[model samples]
Target: MAVIGSVAEFTAEEDWEEYCERLEQYFLANNIKDTETEKRRRAVFLSVTGGKTYELLKTLLAPQKPTENTYEELWQVLQNHLSPKPVVIAGWYWFWTVRQKAGQSVSQYLAELRRLAEKCQFGNFLNDALRDMFVIGLLDTAVQKKLLSETQLTLDKAYHVAMSHESAVQQVEEIQGASKQQVNKVKEHRDPQKEKGVISAEGHPMSQMIVSFEKSCVSRVVTRAM
Candidate 1:
């Protein structure tokens, strides 16, 4: 809610006051126990914006060059000094923190994405992640049992791993009564198998061996990426 931007030059006089009010409201909205830590974070956030928000304010505020990191240097300072961190760490922080406060529902995050898409950077990632998380909740048993079985738990997972994916969600269908569409979607996004041709030492076809080899390569890629 804190409208971080330059003070003396960039922000309009009225907008600065509005930003301060929003910042206060945002902190109150969180209701977290770390009031003291949050205060320090907020202070750093304000200090940075008050000084640096103007350097690029003309470009950011102008219609032609609305760049996202209008306060990049300030953000660096806040991330370094704050504990529990302020909502200025990354472009995604505002949406992520708001999701945290709103019970961490997939629906809630999606709602935020809808709002953010018009104004925020990395909007694509947030929307994609939220949709994927919902699809996973629909199909995966472990996901359902661990996160979705309960409202709050599901909400929490929605916030933390809204963008996470399980590699095998696609191929198998009908896992605990999930929709076929969901399964198909997972399969659609996942990487296709790159089959290494199966040939025995004698130059005979070895279909099973080829399948095994491809699976091994895919597994290794996934493991290393993780």
Candidate 2:
């Protein structure tokens, strides 16, 4: 069996058949006996082939490359075997692209993704959307609450790291709010006359109102003069 020439290029139906045969042979040679592995392997193969076919169809549809009839034929071929994971694939592709820009290795990303998935209680498709922010962060929290709200997941645990972190954040916000309220209360309690520069009980026009009010003041002045 011949492997498809350059998976990045489109192959004829006969070539695709040969490619599948070759892939099966390779898998068998590796002693791939797990049924789940086989199923996922086939799914991945189809998804990749469908993507390649779609790319080729796009190329053929470009101006001056192929006629409308040829484009329609290729489009039909693409539409026939399109896989269900298109949205997942697109998100993963974008994630990888961004990871590349951020200089993060794919292995590290996958490890972090798996960690997040386990943390979020993702049983199915846990490994699939492990790295997706929407999947593991808030969405995971929401899902856990929906399914297990009446159980341990329902009640917030003080020991849970995520909940602890959230609690800390909330505490800081509450303290800040309380501090602001205190400041506002102080401002509200301040005398309006003092705020407007009019002296009250302390002294009116304090600078000029000085009288011989006390023997202590006279003694301090006498000592200073001496």
Candidate 3:
């Protein structure tokens, strides 16, 4: 079948299993099957590979213009070259050392942790380890509390609770900020001395002082006219 957008090109840095799955699925959907004639299958396989993959393909096909081969041979060769033996150690180091950065959202942080976990491939040990790592990496203590308080937890559930709690906290903080701004605006318009109820030496209020000043101005005008 013809594809609409281009299929994703495999890169060395990507998850090996996921990349392989995508390629295999593409082949399966397009009828590039194992039972098919080698000539047609080989052409389709070559069409999909790019970047460093072509180099691997050439090495596998050397001494002859590879007119025929199964897609599985190409798959194995790419996996052998792309996925190194030492990556397990490096993946563990990264997973253990990973911490959530300040201002990073919970979703983004958890997704990163999940990727590192996949690299380790620690079997059944991964579940609780992932859960614990997520809680440990959270930047906010309050959200951490909410996450840990759950009696039975999955990473998915914990993420939901923490994200909702964070949203609620942010909303409350925004409301308080808006309220504080309104109060500040009111105070900005206020007369501080009058609000403090300070009286003049003769015990007249400030309003009387303004009226007296007006009367004095009128008297001065009449005297000038005379």
Candidate 4:
């Protein structure tokens, strides 16, 4: 049967869990079922894994040949090699101490918390742990207070509330900034007119003083002539 999908060579830089998931999907698409002889699936897996990965697997299997192991065994061995489990205590410490960094948005911070929580083994308490960490890590005091005031806060609720608060603050700042600019423009527009009025008022008084001085001089000259 023709295969419907292709699997790329697994690399050290790639996530092992994600790659495994994709590989399983490829198997399903191609009608490669476990009910068939284990040998067929193993051969198919070994063939498509590429030379570099096969060589690594050969080195890992060592004393035994790849053919001696079943498909499930080979997959398990690679999983153990590629994705070693993290220490639970250290993972928990990192998860608890993490805070929302400056310039990071609420969603970005939430993604980081989820990533750290993967190794924490929180099990059934995962959502509660996430919600608590999210509230503690927030840089916005108002958002923190709002979340804290909620009686039935879940991770979903916290995320939505924080996002809404952040959006509202940005909109308010934009409006206030625009208002200040408009006020300054109006003041600038009136300033030239005010200055011109002041100049006209001062000139009128100066012209009257000059006329009075001229009249006094003429009167003095006439009296002297008389």
Q: Per-residue lDDT for 1-226 in model 1, tens only?
A: 4443333322433344345455545445554226456555445444545544534443334553323333344344333433223243453454344432333544454565556443344444655545444444343345445454444443345544433434333222223133334444444554344323542322323434444555665566445423
TM-score of each: 0.22, 0.25, 0.68, 0.78
lDDT of each: 0.43, 0.43, 0.69, 0.81
Native RMSD of candidate 3 (Å): 15.7
Report lDDT (Cα) of residue 103, candidate 3.
84
Backbone collision count in every prediction? 2, 0, 0, 0
What is the lDDT for 143 in model 2? Answer: 36
Q: What is candidate 2's lDDT per residue for 1-226, written digit by digit as tens? A: 5433333333654344445556556556555436656554544444445655545655645653323333235434444554222454455555434322143433444455554343344457553444243223332243334333334321123114333333444455565565456555555666786567654433433312332233345445434422
Rank order (by lDDT, best first): 4, 3, 2, 1
Whole-model lDDT, candidate 4?
0.81
lDDT winner between 1 and 3, please give it.
Answer: 3
Q: For model 2, what is the alpha-carbon lDDT of residue 18?
A: 49
Best by TM-score: 4
Winner on TM-score between 1 and 4 is: 4
Error of 4 at 20 (Å): 0.3
Task: Please give the lDDT score for candidate 1.
Answer: 0.43
Model 1 CA lDDT for position 8: 35
Better of 2 and 4 by TM-score: 4
Tell me which residue pairs clash in candidate 3: none
